[model samples]
Target: MAEPTQNDAHLLIVDDDERIRTLLQQFLTRNGFWTTAARDAAHARKLLAGLDFDLIVLDVMMPGDDGITFTKELRTHLQTPILLLTAKGESSDRISGLEAGADDYLPKPFEPKELLLRINAILRRVPQNDEIIEKPKVLHLGDIHYDIDRGEMWEGDNLIRLTATEVALMRIFSASPGEPVSRSKLVEDLGRDRGQAQERAIDVQITRLRRKIEADPKQPRYLQTVRGSGYMLAPD
Candidate 1:
C-alpha cells in the first residue's frame, strides 16, 4: 500500500463557530489538505458516516455532545487522528481531552502556523504503508492477531479498529515485544510534551487499547503492566 501525500490527506473541522470553522477550512485547504467543515457534533457525525478523513479538528465546547464526549464515542470505532481545540488552557482540561481519546489538543488563540505544525506532527506519528520494509510479523494474543507491518489488529476475519494513538503504541511495543516501555518514554515517543498529565493520558490510552486486545480488560494478559518499569507486550 502506498502512503497518501500531504495534498491527499483529508481533514474534518468541527466547530459551532461558523466564522472560525470557515476560516480554518480555508486556511487548511490553502495549505494543501482537503478540508471539510461541520457546524457541530451532529453534523460532524453525519459527515463522518459518509466520508473518511485522515484527521479531525474538533472544538471542545459545543451546543451538544461536547468534543470530549464525542471523542470518546468516536474512539469506539473510528481510528482517525483527532486534534482538539479548546478555549481552556489548563493542564487538567488538556488531560481530560486526552483521557477521552483525542490524539492531541491545541489551546484556543493559537497561531494558524502552530496548528498546522501540530496537525503535521500528529499525522507524521501515524504509521505509513511505505515505512514497512521488513517482512510482516504477526503477534498472537489468544484469539487476537496484530500485524506489525500493516499496523492492524484482527480477531479471526474481523478487523478491530484502533485509534491513531493506539496504532502508534502498537508500533512501539511491537518494535521490542518483550521489553517494557516507560510511560514517560511513551509520552515522548508519541510527540507529546513531557508532563505527569501526558503520562496519565498515556495510561488512559493503554487502558483503552487493552479493551480491544484483551478478552477481559480488567485482567490484561498480553499488554501487561511492569510494576515500576512501565508496560510490555507479551505476545503468545
Candidate 2:
C-alpha cells in the first residue's frame, strides 16, 4: 500500500530526550507528517491546550508525569490516537499502555519504518471508529443499550463491563448491523491473528454477550449466529 501523504496530519512527539525528539521530528517530517516536539507530558498538555494534533507519540518513562497516567487522564475527554514508546521486551508495560487508552505501543529501539507502519495502521483503524460512531445510533437489546460510540453496553442505568476482545467484536458487528459477519472476517478485524483458536474464542464472547442482552440465552434475539455465514446482530 502506498503511504498516505501525511502533510496535513500533525503528530506531537513527547519525550524528555532532546536528541530523540529532534531526530523523530526530522524523520517524520521527511516521511510527510507535520511534527511537533514536547519535553514531557506537561509540555505536551500545554501544546495540546493551544492546538489540535492528529496523533501523539508519548514515551512511557518520564521524570514526573508518565505516559500511562497522562494517557488515562487525556482519554477522559479526548479520543485522539496515542502511541506509547516503552523499554524493549516489556510486554506487561505495553499491555498497560493499551489499558490506559493508547492506540498502539512500540518498544524503544524500534525501526523508524516500523513506527511509520504502525501509525498508518492505527490511522486506518481510526476511520473505522468514526464510521461506527456515526451509525447504529445505539443498539437496544432487551434492557441493555449498547453505545457504539463509546464501545459501552449499558443495561438500564448500569454500565456493563466488557473485555477488550468482546469490545472489538462488538464494534465489528455493530458496523454491519443486520448483516452476517463471517468468523474469519471477525478474526481479521479483531487483529487477533490466532488461527482457529481465536475464532472459537469469539464464539465464547458471543455466548456471553447474548446472555447479557438476550431474554433467553438458548434462543437469542439480538445476537444470532447464521447457520454457516457467521454472526449477525439484528439490533432493535
Task: State model 2's lDDT.
Answer: 0.78
Off by over 4 Å in 1: 1-8, 89-96
Tell me the TM-score of model 1. 0.87
What clash pairs does model 1 have?
A: none
The number of residue pairs in model 1 that clash at the backbone is 0
> What is residue 129's positional error in candidate 2, in angstroms?
11
TM-score of every candidate relative to the true structure: 0.87, 0.66
Candidate 2 residue lDDT tens string, 1-236: 44674435789999999999999999888888899999998888899999998888999998789999998888767767888899998766776776666766788899988788777655555544334444447888867888887888898888875544456667788878999999888767755444665476466657766766788989988988899999999988
lDDT string, candidate 1, 101-193, tens digits: 898889899988878878887898887867853687999999999988788899999999887888899999999999999999998888777
Q: What's the CA RMSD for each of the models?
A: 3.5, 6.4
Instruction: State each candidate's clash count.
Output: 0, 0
